[model samples]
Target: MIKIVSFVMLIVVMLQGFTLESDYNRAHQKAMQSDKIFIIFLTEKECVACNKELMKIMNAKNVSSLIEKNAIFVVVYKEQKNTFPIEMLYTTQYPTLFFLDKNELFSCKALRGNIQPKELMNCLKLR
Candidate 1:
């Protein structure tokens, strides 16, 4: 009985974690409707660092909470068909974090490379 209960609890907890939208247009529209910033995470398929950084964000309670409260988080893979404006966010690197305001403008400087949890929270708070 205890094992069954624990498994159920674990499933619930995992389901409560932050979710990233893969559709740029839907995410952007939701962000505008919610009056929150849009956070775009650019990653590649074979990037170990990007996966590590994504794990950090997912594991960090503070970062995840802040993002959930104030931003629309979207993950766009390099090889995927996405609607992200390449001119605005041209990057030669993986794991880039771009924050855009409710008006669909750049909120602050883009963050590149691996970012710690606290650093992600700080960056999100800046906008």
Candidate 2:
């Protein structure tokens, strides 16, 4: 019984918290239709702190509320073989966030490295 409980708890923990689609095409399509912006989050496998910080900011109520309403959050790993188009996502940073217009054609300067929740919220409000 204890083992079963532990397994169930593990499953619940694994499924908890935030996640995003890594597919840019799908995100772009949705963005075009919904008048949403694209938050192309370029992450790296070994950047543990960066990943944690992103999760924290994304999970924060203010940041998430603004983002969830205005953007199609697409997560792409920098070190992996990317499935998304690289034209707009081109960047060298390990954990960079590229915010694009609804057309997914133009992007402001990429937000690189650790970013605060308020900073992200302010950016989201611009779109």
Candidate 3:
């Protein structure tokens, strides 16, 4: 029982590690240190369909081999606008993917709205 409990907890933490960061500064710092592109995913709190589509992409097979390794990611909701930098606080849609490098912070706006998993994977390759 003890071994089983420990295994389950380990699995939970490992899964959580793959999820996008909720803090912009931390993700940006990570990007700088790891030489990874920084991507900010913006969504409104009530956007269900958009969130599902994003989940499909993030939870796709070979996830750890792709986006997780290539980018330092953060997700920002409309309600959390005050938490991010003023320049990063704006978005044109309910869901948007903003890709930025350390040299050019918050400058690149990628996708808007629900995106397919294949599309996101393709975009990842170009970055």
Off by over 4 Å in 3: 1-17, 81-90, 105-109
lDDT of 2 by residue, 1-127 (tens): 5346335433432344323655777888888998988888777665676666666665587776677688877766665564665663467666777888876665555677787776677778877
Candidate closest to the true structure, highest lDDT: 1
Better of 1 and 3 by lDDT: 1
lDDT, model 3, position 91: 66
| Candidate 1 similarity to native, TM-score | 0.81
Determine which window of 10 residues in candidate 1 has minimal summed lDDT: 5-14
1 against 2, candidate with superior TM-score: 1
Task: Spell out the clash pairs found in candidate 1.
Answer: none
What's the TM for model 2? 0.74
lDDT of 2 at 42: 79
Question: How would you encode candidate 3's per-residue C-alpha lDDT over 1-127 as one tens digit per residue?
Answer: 5346335534543574554677777888888898887777777765766666556555576643576778776777768644565664556676777778875464444677776656666666766
Q: What lDDT score goes with residue 43 in model 1?
A: 82
Worst 10 residues of 3 by lDDT: 5-14
Q: Choose the strongest candidate by TM-score.
A: 1
